[model samples]
Target: MVGVPTAIAILAFEPPHGATALLALLLLAAAAAGFREPTPLWYIERGWAVLLAGGFAVSTALAPTRPILDRSLLTVAIAGATVAAMGAVRPELLVGLDWQVADQFERTLARYDFGWLGGPPAEAAVRQFAALWQALYPAMLVLASVSALAVTVYLLGRVRGEESALPPLGRFRFSEHLVWVLAAGLVLVALPVGAWADRAGGNIVTVMGGLYVLRGTAVLVWLGASVISSGWIIAAWTLAALVLYPVTMGATLVVGVSDTWLDLRSRLGVAGNKE
Candidate 1:
């Protein structure tokens, strides 16, 4: 009756983050339909409904002539802020998250290994790689939250009599202030705090690094869009990405971080392309 999209969205996350946070948000929003007296909760419910409605109605209805991002900036921005707040308030939430991912990765790698062909490349190597990936789990959570928030906000805007829609990928960008957060995370993990070092720093660095990758992806899309309009090109790129994603992510990370100082959008004329 109400909406099932929230369930679909929550499934994208691990049980820990999904069960606790996502359900809490859903229930809170539901409460607004009858239980809550506050007006803002109504906004949350209405927004959520529109979000679940696939955004088709409002996407075409509101500001159709304007840039898709004209209204979506607020939705995405709120998502970013929500992610930052969650990381700041529950830094330790990532502690269990990392271990869960590590354990899962280790199992998958071992299952796929052919003992005759390199014999899983030593348990130490496997564990090390798992640890490295685990360090990035917190950041992954933040990225997912941003996606959820963008959809939620867009839906909210659509139903609340405000015009909003999700924007094109190329419009995404991270704020400069986050550089300091990443720097602080790196500095903390760099210190001699034994077990605590990675935990403290990983939470910040991974989240920020994920943002950099997103920013770089936007840059890539912007650059590509300049000459390539064919959707098939995207399909081909994604097909190539399955095997080359690690390499692609590495390049994206480098380019994204570099943009902090290089002012890439302006240099590439992507800024002008948008406005």
Candidate 2:
């Protein structure tokens, strides 16, 4: 299910060598995921070596002029593209989700006495909001995949009676070069790209922007952690998120983008180097 769409999406971008790249990426990702949290379980203990070896084999086959790849970024792009491809192939998937959201919205509204707020205008507002939500389904799915990965990592640690090796959210950062991907996305959006390419660019911007928000928040958390207790940090963040969402997000996004250039954590002499 995942591989087919992912391969198709990659081929759309790099037809001649996409399949080989996809195979290499899958091997590398599988190896990294397994090796990061190796278990005494039979399959994991036995299979991770094979996965790593396979990844190396593929890379070697393309050696001398091996295509440069950022394993993490490519993995994420492939996952997001796969999700968007799935929606494209069977749009009813998103339609079903949209219907569920609309149904729940109506049910909630029915339970509330909107009084003057409930009218044709309110109905129109709901319709508009629903349309916006449906359009954002691709970005939502990309974020959902990240959330699911986090949950799975947490749960794996719990099931194994071990602390997760995952770094604290406060220390999160990704490659600074990823800003180029977001920039490329913006250019695509601004230009008269084909409809499909434009939509893909929109998805890229939305997903990357969401990630940078988290990275920016992490920078803030790192700053706060040095001076305040975790409880206070959490409380403050929760309050700000609830009461000043747009302001907080905008500030964080700016901070995140700045961090890429400024390398804020290192400047503060508190680079969390656990990874």
Best by lDDT: 2
Give me the runs in candidate 2 sitting further than 4 Å from their true place. 1-116, 229-237
lDDT of 1 by residue, 1-275 (tens): 13333333333222555444566367446544554554443443354444433332233345445443333333334444554576589986445444555666777776755565556566567668767766665465445544554564455444434653555677666566668988999998899878777786887887778778877888777777876889999779868866899999998998888877887777877573341
Model 2 lDDT per residue over 170-205, tens place: 778877788998998899889986876777788889
Best by TM-score: 2
TM-scores of the candidates are 0.54, 0.61
Poorly placed runs, candidate 1 (over 4 Å): 1-138, 160-164, 272-275
Error of 1 at 146 (Å): 2.6
- Cα displacement (Å) at residue 92, model 2: 10
Candidate 2 accuracy as lDDT: 0.61
Clashing pairs in 2: none
Global lDDT of each candidate: 0.59, 0.61
